[model samples]
Target chain A: MDKLLLLGDEALAQGALDAGLSGAYGYPGTPSTEIFEYVQHSKEAARRNVHRTWSANEKTAMEEALGMSYTGKRALVTMKHVGLNVAADPFMNSGITGANGGLIVAVADDPSMHSSQNEQDSRHYGRFALVPVFEPSNQQEAYNMTFDAFALSEKYKTPVIMRLVTRLSHSRAGIVRTKYLNENEIKLPDNPNQFMLLPAFARVKYKNLIEKQELLEKESENSKYNEYHDGKDRSLGIITCGLGYNYVKENHVESKCEYPILKICQYPLPRKLIQKIIDECDEILVVEDGMPVIEEWLRGYLDNCLKIKGRMDGTLPRCGELDPAKLRTALGLEPYPIKEVPTIVKGRPPELCKGCPHRDTYYALNEAMKEYGPGHVFSDIGCYTLGFLPPFNAINSCVDMGASISMAVGAADAGLFPSIAVIGDSTFGHSGMTPLLDAVNSKANIVAFILDNGIVAMTGMQDSAVTGRVEDICMGIGVEKEHIHVINPLKGHHEENVKIIKNEINYNGVSVIIPRRPCIHIAAKLRKQK
Target chain B: MKKNIILAGVGGQGILSIATIIGYAVVKVDIYLKQAEAHGMSQRGGAVESHLRISDKEIHSDLVPHGRSDMIISLEPMESLRYFPYLKPDGWLITNITPFVNIPNYPEMKHLLKEIKAHKNSIAIDGDAIAKEIGSPRSMNMVILGASAPFLGIPFNMLEDSIRAVFGRKGEDIVQKNLDALNRGRDFAEEYIKK
Candidate 1:
């Protein structure tokens, strides 16, 4: 096959294809969303009828992947790091239950809270699941590992996690070509006892899981994934994992006469590899992305005697992703001469696209809230959350999906005047409606802004649950027909919409604002059709 | 031979597209390849980074460590600087001179330009200008990608094929525009060397 350009997510999808995966399951989330989207959209996948769909959420996605693997098919499940929290229950159990087929779960972690609620590392989840985790530093690894992970999963009869961070999930890289169209064998579980979780069965499985730890450790020992290069000089050794290694190697700042490197990609911590590198060098600098799991592990295993240094010891900061310059400084190399940068361009701070329905909705909201004296809006995660930024600044808080309506109700219960919740069509379906029902039943004086962009725009516009049933769902939730205000967001109806909103704000009960508009991105995309 | 290349940029900058095209081009050359990218928060105006590893032999790991990359290609200047630590001492940096201001701190950006100019082994091109000259500023990504192609061992024709594959039916106009931008970038680099 010829080389093809692939998104980090698409490359992972291709990697899964190369890895002989039979299926993939996931819900859309930025950074991690594209993998499933690609799997769903790829011509090769479609022709082969590979089982790819956006599962309702991460939990279902994981279980479905598990189901496919239970039938002895290779499966890949992916989600953003936070989505793993939603699927953590099954993820933990999959280890104890074991796998009948090859299973790879790719979780893309977001550090620095880019499009996520928190910068949490998903590797911790893999550690918790007691499964081997593979973190690829670049696109080629992303592809190769997706394929390699399946084999490892089936060989070990345990699900493997391929963890990626934002940098590694979305970045592009040059990768050499190999054969394609590989698909895994489909097999069925011979013993129902393997998946059954009754105490008798689960207890035995748990013990097996415990015993598998040693097997996993042993696998890590001779595993080709755990490798080291014997530097001619072994004074100051570098041990790096994932993209952090790329950052280190890019500078070639490794000490010529001092540093040997132990590059760890497979986990359960390859203790032998770490020990060998540590013993060969006077000082060990551990570089890994996100948290210092490796550093902390090395510190504990070496009893802090190895002069092990990394993020935990203030040699590196506890937060933010790292770059090569920082690694150079850590390696005691001269800094690259700083280049004269042109003045950074100050472009428009991103907001909802102009003429977007959310913009009109917020305009009406800001107008109606003049009497309320501001600080009344609660928002949820969507493109509309850009309402919190200036020009709009209409939203007060946006913590997570489905948080807006409930947060608004809480504010109203706490005696805040004219409380308003701004949520999108998809978020309302994800978790927003129950709070609206709660507010209606409790007679809370809150207005919920249901900005219907007709899709889940924040995560690349996957289908929204309420796309067709918004009205019935709202009505069923007890929102009064009279108070359900529907208005086009881009139309010049802010004054009338403001009047309706003010009327609802004074209603002393729950009100629903259905600001309907197409997302500009989606709209433009659709318009190109005409 | 093992080569590590890093690509860095802000979200929505088309850096990933450039990287993907390059990844495809490299594979067309029949080398063992491992690559990964960072996204997620990137869609929210955050920085994005990607790592590319090309080898002649089978690869066990997908990641490349610090100080080992042969080159750094940045679609934006500050983003390139952000990944500066990854570049080898003799490594090449290919970046567009286009600027993005309002990073979290360093309110006075005029002074930041001085810092960028002081860097060594940096090849900065007015990719935005080239894109505008060829067509859209969005094509700046392709221009910067074109500037780095020769040094990265990717042929322009291979990249064009990848572009066509990705863009599908839209490949005709997009490929032509991007090709123009790329040629302009290559010409600029050639002219800079002469100077």
Candidate 2:
């Protein structure tokens, strides 16, 4: 077998493609974005006619994958940890409905809030949904687990969640290719009411799901990924999960730790292996990536006879990702001397690109809003979010994907005159359109600026849904044709754009001002291609 | 043998490309390689770093431990000193003397170079100038990679082969220019060491 250097996300993508994945659906997000991008660019996937397309959002992506599973085709849907929150309704119910074919929900988590609003753990979602979870420690394991995730999903008739954190997802390592599996044939469920999920069927399905827990735990206990290594010393036991195992092994380079170790990659606690370590060692230490999930479970309400040390006891820091340095401190190893950064080194925060249209848009918008006030503009996510930093301190708020429009509407309702909302074209399609319709219905006095960059622009320039059609969508949504204005956002047009913005701001009804330009990065890439 | 390196530069400065080229070369020889990259938000002109670990045996952590990095191969002088804490006391610092002054408060270039040169084991070269002199300004990353090639524990020919493989798709002209840039950088470093 040939080996290929691949990121953990790429390995998962290749593994799933080799495992007969029929469709890969996802929205562009950091860490998880490369999974879908890999499939989209794979010649093998294109040759095999595999479905690869970006969904409107995570919720739609999840539902579409479920639909594919219903048709007896293996499906893979990916999203970041927070994206699971948007798809929670379908995700939580998918376990009850069960699956006719294998389904893998791959969620990449950011432990230290890198490129995310929060560092929420995805393992909790796996537990909440009562679905088996696979958290691979390395690229090879990520590939192997994804190849096996489908079988596990089909065997248990449930959607499996493969949880990956930023370090594992973004890092690259060599992985040997595995034997490919053919695509699944279209086969319907034997039970007619399997997916109905009516009140009558819900009870029976819920009961069946509960009954399957014991078998799931049995699978976890016997899983090859969950290994219990015996050691001579029994003073302290170590339970490492996912990347935590790597940090632990990194500390013990020349020799293995004397403590009995239970390395967990499969979920459902793997109670038997955990108990074996607890019984052998006097004290247990739980090391996990995101939260103290297993640690909290091991230290339930009742006090145990054996002393347990983990995030709770401050043996490890309760928050942030685990690193080799942090693990060494936790294990009572000698600390390395810290080097101090020179005072001359200034902070270099991310800023708008040199030729970014957002800079021009912000400059014009700031000029327009000078008379009104500083706190009137609400922004949304994207490259334009960088406008909140440095010289162009233009935006007042940036909460979630499409909060700008809705927040502006709420403020307008509370009598804030000339409430301004700024959003990107991609974000408007993701979650901004419905709120714009709400403002139209309520006749709120707000000016929504859709920064039409003709691409996603933030997550490496994926196609924007609202590109070339922002005006049609706004007009169809009942915004008066006269109120919707499109202006070029450039240095030459700054004064004109500011004038147009001020005009829209003075309008009483819902008005949308679109400053249209292709993202400078995408423009440069296109020029290179040319 | 293990080589733990920190590749640092401002975002879009092509440090990841150097990592990729080394990664391709390392895997061809059946060596274990793990590279942890900075992606997403931090990539928009902010300072970025990647931890590249190559070992004959399996690697444990994707990240290199604090003060355990064998070398810091940087594309910018200021970015090179940023990861001083991660470099072992004996570790080499190979950096391009050019400054990527994206921020308004970027320190004076002479002062930055002085701070970098204060280190006991440091090699600062004008990689962009060398690449431009070789008729390919975009090969600055290749120049830095070549300058650090001696310290990488891999053979120079292997690094050249990796460069050929990575840029093979860009045509022979590109591959030849980058190879020229690499050799120029290697010559500069060898001369500096002899001095």
Candidate 3:
């Protein structure tokens, strides 16, 4: 009964380990990256022979996990919400293929775009995939539901989606030790018909999925994961799901009689539970972290569901993670005001570190583009995006993982002045290679900046494709040997680096500017370990 | 009664290790437990927070409310103040009073200790000095965490166990040093804190 202090993401990984998962595959993304990283580092997980690795990207990760599940081994795929978009091809198709083992897809949504490009809800993906989705209300439930999700996956022959928001993924809570199950044997499909995805087979599987919807709803209605806590308050009924439910229950723990509550952790729109809340209370308030999917459904299900109020009704903001203050306001509790202070924490936005190599590289790029004017820089995702802050403010665009190179090419072809693309080593591998190839073949005038930090730097220094060899990749992408410039991004030689950037910017053909330096954090970690 | 407290800070500031010590030690007096942390983007010096919700009864909500937290333990002054809306008016705030230069806004930083000192029951400790005295500035978060121990109602040995649990695997020498840092902060708080 020893308690281990766990991050919400780590707890989910440990929960998968405790639940007897055979393997975990994922691509690193904010809020969800630690799930696989923790699994990779855990002695218990390793002792049980759990397979853990960072896949090429989210799609490869999802497919690899699906392949493991096909062999009748419990496999968990972890990814940030947009990672679901990358994996959507395999995700939407997996429902038709079906799973042999317990397959759980844990999607961590970053509402308010904290560290992500989008604040998408993966629950919609779950609904689209026709798989039952499980959202934990807290860390313990994150553990329990992860364990239960594996069972549900096995029982229904469908991959279960476990959705987490930034609050749920990053938060910590006390979790009781549960019985651990270690299953190493792989159970292959008994019938080949399950793997065959011919149109006939897919149609049959699709129909089977349709028939299983009732079972999913039944499982949700009868789940130990989802519950109806009878409270004292019947007038202002509160129906909350996921972490939003936790906020409601804790703040109004004493007001049980006044507020009847239906707490949902598992999904497929538990209509029966919604009905119970509607029938019991005069005014119902539906609280959820993101989107009004359930609340929207309940309104139609039970004659507008007793004057429904929630995010849709402006009872809660339709965006961002929901906390107790927002919940308290929805329930008519006294609001807590933030103390008015003259000078609090300084509003200094994040920038490259003092000795960061990216700093000099960005400085060079900015100087080279002085004649080109602004909006000519298309940047990729990484620590280099911090260049958009103060002193530098060099990057004009940062859309997604590897949009910089392609966007820059299009802009250059459209006759933009000195269009340059700056992406990190990790991001270049993630999705930059294809665009770089396109630029090479089309003979575009865009200059691509590959900031090689020898690691993923932004997502905790995990390994990347170009981690060890950036020079070779640029050369392979058909950059002229003379134009493929590799320079250390340190201070005192910022002017020389800027001169190199100017030469490349002036080049009317494809060019690659390689800024070489170790990330400050990574260098320190290496030094400490040594 | 059980009170759930959340301590948040930037990565290199030792937030996780400090939370571990508090989690291990608090269990001895209260039915305390701490969850394992999984920070994805802490590598880029991103903001990180750990939830330590301890209570007399079992706690279901792992996250502390925006304004209902009993205490906000911070290693970096800015990180502590960033989550200031989460702290209750009557709650305690303990932070390291070091001035980290704002690199982008170079040569300019508004001091936080003066404003924090004027707030209710807030105490700023020389966590860096205590940690250095214990042979590591990396242990500064533990010092600030230790400053909140007595206020948290957790026994000394309980914290010692958490300290031991986290650093136990690293080495015995590190465990002793971090524990020393924790005690040094505790002693400083005991002598200087008015509340």
Candidate 4:
């Protein structure tokens, strides 16, 4: 077997490819973005003509994957934790519909909010959807679990959720490749209405889903990924989940910890093994990333019969990602005294790239809106979100994808004249379109600036769905043709761009201004390639 | 044997390339390796660091505990000092003297150098100048890697071989230029140690 060094995201991608993935759909996001990228760049994937492309957003990606699964093909959909929120509608409902082939939803969580708005755990979502979840401890396990997750999905006829944190998703390690499996032949669902969720059908499907929980727990208890190890000392029982197991094992290198240990990678609690640990040891410590879902459950509502220690007990810090240093302190070991970073080393926060088109656009917007004051411009996510920092300080609000346009419209309805929305090309396609339609239909007074930078510049330059179609899309949504203005965002065109923005601001109905240019980084890479 | 290294530099400066070469060498020798990298927004000219842990035995954490790192290999002077607390009391700090002046408030070069020299164990080399002299200005990262190679615990030749393997896809010219850059940097460090 050949070993290849891979990030956890790449390992999952490779695993899916080797496990006969027919299609992969996703939106570009930190930690989870690389899964689809690896498949898109894989020679094997291209040879197999696998459906690998960026979807409009996570919801569309989830629905597309479900469609593929309905055709009896294995499909993988990935997104960051917050992205799951966008896809939650289809994701939660998919449980009632059940899967036709195999469906795996790989959601990479940011426990410490690294490159994220929040650190909401995805494990809770797994429990909410009544789905079995697999959380790998290392790169090898990430690969192996992904390979097995499809079979688990097909067996239970439910989408399997594979949860990963920032550390696991971005960290690299060596993993051995497994024998490749061929693509599944296309077939239809056994029952015609398996996917139909009319209230009557949904009731029966929901009941069937409820009944599968027992078997899911049984499979989890017998899973090779979940194990119980006995130790000579019965003082402390250690229950580790996912990457928590790695940190624990890292501490006890020579002969493993002298405590009864249960390592859980497959979820739905694995009660019997956990009961064994609780029954044997004098005290129990639960180590898990994100929320203490397992820890809270083990304690139960009022049955505090045994002592349980974890995040809730201040044994570990309540927030942030876990590491060896924190674990050492939790185990009562004195930490080594490290020197402090000198005050001279100033903070270097991320900023807009020099010569970035967004900088110019923000500069012009800042100049144009000086009279209206600072509270009017609403923004969406992307590299342009950095406009809120430094000299620009241009955007007033940035609260999720597509919210800018709708929020600006609502503000305008409340008599804030010249209300403006600044959004990115990729984001405009994601959730921006529907909101724009709503504004147009209601005839809301708002000037929506679509920062059209050709590529999805923030997440390593993936293709944007609205590359050359921004203006046409505005027109299709019933915005007046004359009010849809495209201006080059550059120093040479500064005055002209500012004037255009001002003109749209004064427009009585929904207007759009597109500040268009290629992202400097992507442009340079293209120039070098040529 | 255990080696805990902090690879520091401004984002988009190819710090990961140096880590990749060393990681390849570590893997070829059957050593355990774990690297925690700063990704996403930080890659856009923000401060970036990679905590790389290598050991003959299994390693526990992806992060290097504060004050326990064996070496700080930096691509810029200020970025090197940024991880000052992580460097063990007697640990080495090898950095490129070049200043990446992307920000307006960058400290004066003379004052920065003096602050760096105040450390008990530190080496500052003009890696950009050496890379340019060797006709591979883009290989400044390789030069910094070479200057710190002697203190890496791994055999120097192993790094050279790893460099070749990592860059082999780009053809022979690139491979040779990087090799020369590495040698030039290592030679400079060897002489500085003697002095």
Clashes of each: 79, 0, 22, 1
Q: CAPRI band of model 2?
A: high
**Comparing to the true complex, what docking class would candidate 3 get?**
acceptable
lDDT of 2 by residue, A1-530 (tens): 88999999999999999999999988888879999999999999999999998998888999999999999899999999888988999999998998778999999999997788888898998889898999999999989998788999998899999999999999999999878999999998778788999899999999999899999999999999999989899998999999999999999897678888899999887988988998888899899999999888788878465488988889999899889999999999987775667777888888899999999999999999999778999999888889999899999897788999999999999999879999999889989999999999999999999999889877887888777999999999999999999999889998888888888888899999998888987887768889
Residue pairs that clash (backbone atoms under 3 angstroms), model 2:
none
DockQ for all candidate structures vs. native: 0.23, 0.81, 0.40, 0.67
lDDT of each: 0.76, 0.91, 0.79, 0.90
> Which candidate has the top score in TM-score?
2
> In model 4, which runs have C-alpha deviations exceeding 4 angstroms?
A254-256, A301-306, A525-530, B108-111
**lDDT string, candidate 4, A1-530, tens digits:** 76788888999999999999999999999979988999999999999999998899999999999999999999999999999999999999998887877899999999887788888899999999999999998888899987789999998899999999988888888888977888899889999999999999999999999999999999999999999999999989999988888778766665558888899999888989988999899999989988888988888888475589999889998888888778878877667677677667777778888889999999899999998888899999888888888888998898998999999989989999889999999999999999999999899999999999899887888999989999999999999999999898999999998888888888799999999888987887768889
Task: List ranges where model 2 is wrong by over 4 Å.
Answer: A301-306, A525-530
The stretch of ten residues in a row with the least summed lDDT in candidate 3 chain A is A340-349
Specify the highest-DockQ model's number: 2
**TM-scores of chain A, one for each prediction:** 0.92, 0.97, 0.95, 0.97
Position B57, candidate 1: lDDT = 61
CA lDDT for candidate 4: 0.90
TM-score of each: 0.82, 0.98, 0.92, 0.97
lDDT of 3 by residue, A1-530 (tens): 77755667887888998888889999888889878899999998778778886787888889999999999999999999998998999999987777889999999998767788778788888889898999987777788888789988888889899998887787665566688887747778888789788898889889999999999999999988778887676777788888777787767666553577788889887778878878888888888887777777667655544478888768899878676677778878877766543344545444566788888887777777887688888998888888887789899898988899999989988998688899998889878888998999999998899999888777787887767677788788787789898887877778888888888888898889888878887787778889
